[model samples]
Target: MFKPSAEQIIKVMQGKGYSVYDTPAVDWNLNIVGIRANDPEPGTFNDTLAVFQRLQGAWNICYYQITTDPSLHYLTHPVNSSGTAILKEGQYKGAYQLDIHNRGLDSGHLALCQRLKPVTVYRDSNRDNKLNLLEGKTQTGMFNINIHRTCEDYIQRQRFSAGCQVFAEQRQFAEFIRACQASEKAFGNKFTYTLLHERDFQ
Candidate 1:
């Protein structure tokens, strides 16, 4: 058991904006670590694990409680069963959110320092085994994905008779039209595709 000195505590309080209320003299957990005051600012912080690299004789501290009761056989571990709260680095209390992927080669998916509220998805509808876009639940449900995509190999046999695949932007545009069901009313399959709508903005 390490005892915190009064001078060290006062120095920490004065140097950091944190007040005595925020820094109650509490026993720190072994996992919590400290950093040196001279170290550069950290670039990446893990949200899943609430650990900080601080300088000083810095120590590990857990949010969970370790009782002083000698009768207990083990340290009282905090049960975060709900797993609802995601402790992000930098911020003391909030989960980190991010965009799924990048649209280009140069710029990667960057995380905004902003925090977002956690959302829950559930399939509650009258339809049976059909996707309803209006249901509000995204395609995030574990069981909601198409099972055919998971098969190791397709049962049907096929032959490659076609030539090299070309970059057909027109065909790609037509595919998008069928996907959106916007051109189902039109009655022309052989006709060449054309730009349907053009926006003024670049």
Candidate 2:
């Protein structure tokens, strides 16, 4: 339950050689960062997704929410059958653009989609139901790792995320999308997402 301030997050990002969009003129330019919790348990909403921006003259956290890992459920029961895709740690610039997730259907929703460019990921194909971040095969391509929301209610398992960044609550995800829309209007459709491990903070 450790809450990180905007400064702390930025410091970690800088230390890790990640980008920090702190230009004062570019207000509301969203900086999305996902922190993977240190917990070893799979299929759990133990990660955090934070949205930071340079509002006015200061850096601030515009939106923060509890989000599951990009491959939390896939760590156990992978959907790909071939392997589970675990997003690599780093910043992917302009990797996602605003688009309709599950478009033209009842479940369609606003989301940051990875159709703009390719991203690197580790394919855990061992089928051991364990996280093999380093032992997996590295692949780079369009894997449709969208940022969206999960079910409205608090569920036990992370059934929504199959290599996508997923918010745990529906309401919070709406708020996140609103922020993203504002950023889209101010800046552009492309966005950068940075993934970090909890140990990076330590």
List TM-score per model, in order. Answer: 0.16, 0.88
How far off is residue 13 in model 1, in Å?
2.1
lDDT of 1 by residue, 24-54 (tens): 2422111121121121111111111112212
Taking the tens digit of each residue's C-alpha lDDT, what string does model 2 give over 1-202? 3457788888999997888887798778888988877884455567778888888888778545554354445666777766778778788889999898878877778888999889887777776656777744878889888888767432455466667877777788888888889988888888999987778888
- The positional error of residue 164 in candidate 2, measured at the CA in angstroms, is 0.6
Against the hidden true structure, what lDDT does model 2 obtain? 0.77
Highest lDDT model number: 2
Candidate 1, pairs of clashing residues: 29-61, 32-59, 32-60, 32-61, 34-54, 35-54, 35-55, 36-55
lDDT of model number 1: 0.20
Residue-level error in angstroms, candidate 1, position 137: 23
Runs off by more than 4 Å, candidate 2: 68-73, 152-158
Per-candidate Cα RMSD to the true structure, in Å, reads 28.0, 2.4
Candidate 1 has what TM-score?
Answer: 0.16
Worst 10 residues of 1 by lDDT: 158-167
